[model samples]
Target: MIVGVTGGIGSGKSTVVNFFLELGNIAFYHADIEAKNIINSSVKVKTKIEAFFGKEAYKDNVLNKKYISNIVFHNPESLKQLNAIVHPEVKKHFKNFVNQHKNKEYILYENAILFETKSHHTCDFIISVYCDLKTRISRIKNRDNISENAILDRINNQWKEDKKLLQSNYLITNFAQIETKNQVNHIHNILTKKRKLI
Candidate 1:
C-alpha cells in the first residue's frame, strides 16, 4: 500500500516522517527530493524549465532554486506551469519506485503538495502533519534564511492546515518529540496491522 504524508511548509512533517523511518518495515519515497534529482539529471526537464523560465533556472547544469522559488511562490500561474513540467516526470519516477518496493507492506509517499498535485488519489491512506503557525514559522526560520513573508508566501501556496487535516485519514500534531513519536507510533501500529489483514 502507498501511504501519502503531507503538510505545509515547516510543519514538522519531515520530522514526523523521520520517526516513521525508525520503524523497520516501511519504504519511503520523498517526492520533493526526487523532483530535484530529476530536474538536475534530466536534460529534457532542464531544457523545458529554461525554455519557459529563461536560462536563469539553472547554473553550471545545476538548478538555481532561489531563482525558481522567486518566480513560483509569488506567481501562482508560474508555480502551476512548473508543476506541469515536473509532476508528470515525478509520477513516472514514483511508479518505478513502487515497482521496486513491491514486496514491502507499505511505502510512504512524502510530498509537500500531495493533495495539491492530486497525487493523494494514488495513496491508499493519507497522513497530514500539523503544527501551529508560530511554531512552523520558528521552525522555518531555523532551517532557512527566509523572511516570514517569504515563508507565508510558501504557506499560502499550500492548502491550509485545517483543510488538509479535515481531508486526511491520519494526523500527527507535532509539538514535541515525545508526543510526536507517540502519534507516529500509533499510526505505524495501525498501518502494520492493516497490512497483515490485507
Candidate 2:
C-alpha cells in the first residue's frame, strides 16, 4: 500500500517519517528531495524554470532558491506557474519510485503539500501531521534559520489543517518527541492490525 504522510511547513512531518524509518517496515520517498533532483538534472525543466523566472533561477549550476522563492511568495500567478512546471516532473519521478518498490509491504510518500497538490489521491491512505501555528513557526525558525516572515509566507501557501483533515485517514499532532513517537506507534499498530501483517 502507498501511504501518503503530509503536513504543512514546520509541522514535524519529518520527525514522524523518521520514526517510521526506524521501524524498518517501509520505504520513504520525500518529494521535495526528488523535485530538487529533477530540477537540477533535467535540462527541460531547468530551461523551463529559467524561461519563466529568468537566469536568476540558477547560480553556478545550483538552484538559487531565494530568488525563485521571493518571486513565488510575492505573487500567486508566479507560484502557480512554478508549481505547474515542478509538480508534473515530481509526479513522474514518484511513479518511477513506486514502480521500483512494488514489492514492499507498504511505501510512504512524505511531502509538505500533498493535499494541496492533490498528490494524496494517488495513495491508498494518508496521514496528516499537525501542530499549532505558534509551535510550527518556532520549529521552522529553529530548523531552517529563516526569519519569521519567510516562514509565515511558506505556511500561508500550504493547505490549512482543516482542509487536509477532511481528506486524511489518520491525524497525528506533534508537540514533543514522546507524543510524536506515541502517535507513530498508534498509526503503525493500526496499519499492521488492519492488514494482518503483524
Candidate 3:
C-alpha cells in the first residue's frame, strides 16, 4: 500500500517520515530529492528550465535553487509555469519507483505539495501534518534560516489546513516527538491489522 505524508512548510512532515523510517516497515520517497534529480538529469526538463530562466538556472551542473526560488516565489505565474514543467517529470519518476516496489506492504510519498499536483490520488491513504500559523513560521525560521517573508510566501503557496484536512485520512499535529510517535503507531496498527497488509 502507498501512503502519503504531506503538509505546509515547517509542519513537521520530515519528522513524521523519520518516525516511519525508524519503524522499518516503510520506504520513504522524498519528493524534493527526486525533483532535484530529475531537474539535473532530464534533458527535456533541463532545456525547459534553462529556456524559461536562462543558463542562470544552473551553475556547474548544480541547480541554482536560491535563484530559482527567488524568481518563482515572487511571481505566481512563474511559479505555476515552473510547477507545470517539473511536476510531470517528478510524477513520472515516482511512477517508475512504484512499479519496482509492488511487493512492499507500505511506501510513503512524502511531498510538501502532494495536493497541489494531485499526487495524493496515487496513494491509498494520506496523512496531513499540521501546526498553527505562528508555530509553523517559528519552526521554519529556526530550521531553515530563511527570512520571515520567504517562509510566509511558501506557506501561502501551500494548501490550507482546512482543505488538506478534508482530503487527508489522517491528521497529525506534531508538537513533540512523542506525539508524532503515537500518531504514527496508530496509523501503523490501522495499516497492518485493519488494512491487513502482509
Query: Judged by lDDT, which candidate is best?
Result: 1
TM-score of each: 0.97, 0.95, 0.94
Global lDDT scores for all candidate models = 0.92, 0.87, 0.87
lDDT, candidate 2, 1-198, per-residue tens = 788999888888889999987875687899989888988888998999999999999999888998998999888789888888988999998999899987776789998889767798899889999899999999889988999999888888878889998989999999888988988988887886665552
Instruction: Identify the superior model by TM-score, candidate 1 or candidate 2.
Output: 1
Candidate 3, residues 1-198: lDDT per residue as tens digits? 889999888889888988888775567788988998889988899999999988999988777999999998889888888889999989888888888877666888999999988888898899999888899899988988999999988888888889999999999889988988999888877876744744
Report the CA-based lDDT of candidate 2 relative to the real structure: 0.87
Candidate 2 regions off by >4 Å? Answer: 196-198
Model 1: weakest 10-residue lDDT segment is 8-17
Model with the higher lDDT, candidate 1 or 2? 1
Instruction: Please identify model 3 stretches exceeding 4 Å from their true place.
Output: none
Clash pairs (backbone) in predicted model 1: none
**Clash number for candidate 3:** 0
